[model samples]
Target: MDKSLEKSLTLWLKQQQTVCAGYLKLTVLFGILTGLCLLAQAYTLASVLDGLIMQQLSLLTFYPELIALLSLTIFRALLAYAKESSGFIAGKKLRAQVRQTVLNKLISLGPSFINTKPAGTWANIVLEQIEDLHDFYAKYLPAMMLAGFIPLIILAAIVPINWLSAMILLVTAPLIPLFMVLVGMGAAEANRKNFSALQQLNGHFLDSLRGLRTLILFHRQQAEIDKIANVSNDVKQRTMSVLSLAFLSSAVLEFFAAISIAILAVYFGFSFLGHLEWGSFSLLPPTEHRLSLFSGLFVLLLAPEFYQPLKDLGTHYHAKAKAIGAAESLVTLLNIQDSSLTSHITTSLIASSKASHTKIDLKTWELEANNLKVFTHDGECLLGPISFTISGQQKLAVVGASGSGKTTLVNLLLGFLPYEGSLKIQGIEFNQLDLSHWRNNLAWLGQEPQLFHGTLMDNLRLGNQTLSTEKAWELLAKANIDDFVSQHPLGLKLSIGEQAAGISVGQAQRIALARALSRDANVFILDEPTASLDSASADAITQSLTKETTAKCLLIVTHKLSQLGAMDTILVLEKGQLNSSGSYDELMAQNGLFCQLNAQTAYDIDLQTSLGLNS
Candidate 1:
């Protein structure tokens, strides 16, 4: 019923032919061959019946006719196999291409794009929804063509023998497809709702699984179960509705096909009884009053075969309905990047650390932002108008209250969003730099270590395999994870869990720190690196990073506000604007937010006192 959904489906169907027409054409060829074979079988069977019954010929004399029928059946069977195999290959290739396009689109859009939708919805798009389109490509699309042509072939064979029967078959044929279109509209809508309900239910289930321990701790597991049950019931009802429409369409098709066949049968029967002769076509020099037994039997035999393609199409049409439902959602997701609202990217995703300083250009390691502003899709500025410049191996800390644009600024620096003003890196416009290469030159460590399931050494290299074992071991000692590694039998070869599941959170942060240090990066962006740990563990991580900061320009976005003795400059941000920029001593004298934050500092500020600012 939705015009937009119907329009999108039409456009999407047109796209499939261009992408895999070579494979899909084979499905059409085999389907037509099978139709020809069906007509041949009818003719052979009718001839054999006529010879034995009307001509009084012995079965042995008509053995060739019998053999022809058997051969046609065998040939049709082989064509059926080729048809099915070709259809499968067509669907498989199309799905592979669709999935690859989806993946590449997602990659270009990155995490900011992905986080907007439910994980389960994305999984459904990538897995279930694209997969649901197989039937459309493999069965429904081919059937669409065969249904049109195959019936015409049957009509061609029938018209010379009995035009009235062919007329009855042709006129009633449109009714099945006409009514099917009406039912299919409802089926498509129901399937869409069913897929939506499935996505929601799956998302809720995965969330519940992830939070099961917390749910049990709060004694809400049973309530969660009840909620899931209600959603599951919605999915069940939607599924039944779709099946009900499919059955209704089939019932309508069968009813019309039976009525059409019966009309032909009754005409042939009355003529045989010499009660009617008006409907029978005259094929001889003298007009025939009644039909011969052979002609009548042949037409009767081809009756079911006449409506067969339409019936086959009616069955496969459900696949079209299902694919329409899935394609509608997938089209929206696939078009996200092309949408005007999301495509403006202004900053570089990569940058060389300010201190590296080897490029030929002036201020090659400098970063400058003048009146820079970043607005979200909804037009609200998350970071703005604040400008700063950094050069040399300057260690700076950005301190702000919650919602003071710390995360937004980090994203802007990392080139996740578009900016409205001037941004320069290493004397080059930030927008002109290669983001991937710039990212390779910098190191980033977050609060929770991003550990995948692999050897400890692999996690340490962080996808760059050029780091030597000796360098990795040195970083391990610096981060205080060497003690644990030495105690373990595998050392760096020890397997870590996905997201550091096998290791404690404290130990995980240490490994992340070690990994960051091993990169020998020129600029390190450490964001809330100690947020999850206790005072002792936090102090240990802070101590480990301070010793490794001399050669690199380190930017820390932190709430700790402690140990400022080692910081060269700390910029205090209030809301989205810069409030103050000073050293620990200057800020303490200025009595700004930095001073108040330092006043509340709970960690031992002198824990890493020896690693003071050198520049």
Candidate 2:
């Protein structure tokens, strides 16, 4: 990772601490209290040993000191427990807030933006990547501060007794963190590669599972399995490499701490034998030069405690690296700007609109577009600078060849794509109206029907839970699926699997249509509604849709010429531009793109009939 990027991620991680700042402070407080207790325990133990060995005191005479020592031990344990609990709470609150932030960002970007990435890649980011931040907040962050404060506290306690030992500890303290950083740089890079490999594996494995039937039909299941295996093995190797670095960091910390303590032990032994008497000083007797057992023992007892915090910091340094790797992906996703969405709507505008209870009359609603165009993120125009008009009860049909901007126009009207020119509804600019309110007044059905695992009533009432059973049945009847649903033993309660596993595609499409009708929307947009149905099913659906949408504005995109005869207007598009627009009979008489499309549709139908493929 670049140094600047790593610094930025570290800064970002620190900013999130504000959410649980109180808990983090409590954790640090408990840790400081625990360190203080350690110093008192060491002092008491050293005094008791000095009294017994030097002053020839009886062990039974020290009952109060012994009891005090035991009580301090129990109190320190409780403080340690509180510290752990506080850190855990901090981590839990931060993780929940970050996860919700990510979810809200994804929702705001909309489905068109989300569908560009694989489902498994998003799943990994939302689930596994967020989970990796737990330890950084819980352990590593608190330990970072404690590592500095606790060691200084120990040094403060020792400087009066033995300045040489204090200097020795202070000199070796920098080595542990210096080596930790050296090993951690590689560990962080390895973790980043590991996360990338895991994301790829997840996407590939899920895609294969979704298309398992197609793979089997094509006899490529074995090839897919081998590819998955190779990806999984790569992830394993990267994981092992990260662990190796983590262990090496721990080893380095321990080695430096051991060597520092050994040097202290050798100096204290020489002082006891009168070889280094200048380093030891007694405050009560200025003339005394001999080293006392109390000072030597106290410094030795506090030696391990001095290095404990640094060692713990080295151990948790890996967590910091792991969190940085995870944050790289999360920050990138949250930084994406959905330029197509109008986000500058003022709060006061929404407030005033709601206060006045503003509403538009559906019967007089009109949509007009002038020189409208759509461009990709890279500034490539995908749709035209064409013009059109739609009023209440108008039935318009958009017919064009593949990649002729049919879908792009529908997406623009649906508010999924940004436009360059004017698009107004009821004389109001489209971007000025509240998007949620505008969407509620429109109904849309795509080429593929989406149905969850539920009953007929559940699917139909998805948009309006308060819809009565009779009203649901009326919707199903309008979509011409009441008979099929009523024939099932469960009637409205009939069970279905995901994507309507127990029913045919035509039946699922009808249920989806009924669901859309339940919304009671003013405008209906259908894209290839009967594209996969047989002749009987297609005709039934077409007749029912035509009857139901007679009183509302309808925009249908289709290639079937049979459904075009009754349309009020037909738009013929050639390569992202509108070639012509007129009534069905008028376009047919023009002998242009519309006529050519009609001839091509008829020829394909005749060809299918001759090959017996239509059966």
Residue range 77-192, candidate 1, lDDT tens digits: 99999999999999998999989888876665555556777777789889999999898989888988998889899888878777777888889889888878877767877888
Highest lDDT, which number?
Answer: 2
TM-score, per-candidate, Cα-based = 0.87, 0.89
Q: Which residues of candidate 2, in runs, are more than 4 Å off? A: 52-56, 281-291, 338-364, 377-380, 426-429, 606-615
Error of 1 at 72 (Å): 2.2
Cα displacement (angstroms), candidate 2, residue 500, comes to 3.8
Model 2 C-alpha lDDT per residue in residues 439-493, reported as the tens digit of each score: 6888888777788898878887786778899999998888778999888889999
Question: lDDT of all predictions, in order shown?
Answer: 0.77, 0.83
Q: Which is the leading candidate under TM-score?
A: 2
Against the true structure, candidate 1 reaches a TM-score of 0.87
In candidate 2, where is summed lDDT lowest over 10 consecutive residues? 344-353
Checking candidate 2 for backbone clashes, the offending pairs are: none
